[model samples]
Target: MYELKTKENDSSVIEFIENVDSPKKREDAYKLLDIFTETTGCQAKMWGPSIIGFGSYHYKYESGHEGDAPLVGFSPRKAKISLYFATGDTKREELLKDFGKHTTGKACVYINKVADIDVDVLKALIHQSVAFLRETYPNQ
Candidate 1:
């Protein structure tokens, strides 16, 4: 019996974005909302306390750790904007090659602002992540 801390909930995405501390990050949050919405054709949902996520998929690992997670998402944090995409997708690296300035972590792409990255590449990443998840988790 394990609990997933980042489960999706009935939180207000707009309110969350509006509360982003930095004015610039707040503005970029809105832009990202639009881009992710348009690209994934999925409405935004609040994941956990902070992440603004799109479509979701359920994943069951070999160890039986299972949970549903958003296909793609982003959070405008105090330090940097965190972009969430499917981690194991090989296509992600290819697309990131053309993506503008950003730093990658184990599960996030960090950007200072929306203008710091290529919106088109961001869209492609979103698209690929969703497709990969759907194919990997077909019945979800």
Candidate 2:
């Protein structure tokens, strides 16, 4: 069996943000916290040591692998901030077009700072991700 490393924990989201090495990143983390919470209507929770996640869902693939993951989250890393959203959501790509400057990986959207992106687009992404996950994994 494979273990999921980024399980949610009872860690302090505020403390984690406070410890960010860069003051600018720390401030942006706070800004993101507000945006995600308001957009998803879910309180922020710490996932693993670094991810500040809002809302959660349990998903199991056909291969029998199952785990709980946040509907949306972000981590303020040294190089760039990572935004975690639902994978396979087509609407995500559409919104990203107007999301200002950002880079995307398989399931993450990385940005340099909050000021570099449109806050409205960020909120839309969070909402769309949550909706997609709830629809995809209704059992959870």
Colliding pairs, model 1: none
Ten residues in a row with the worst lDDT in model 1? 113-122
Model 2 lDDT per residue over 29-74, tens place:
9999988888888889999999999888998889988899998999
Per-residue lDDT of candidate 1, residues 34-107 (tens digit): 99999988899999999999989999999999999998999999999999999888999999999999999999
TM-score of each: 0.97, 0.98
lDDT of the candidates, in the order given: 0.92, 0.93
* Model 2: residue 50 alpha-carbon error in angstroms: 0.7
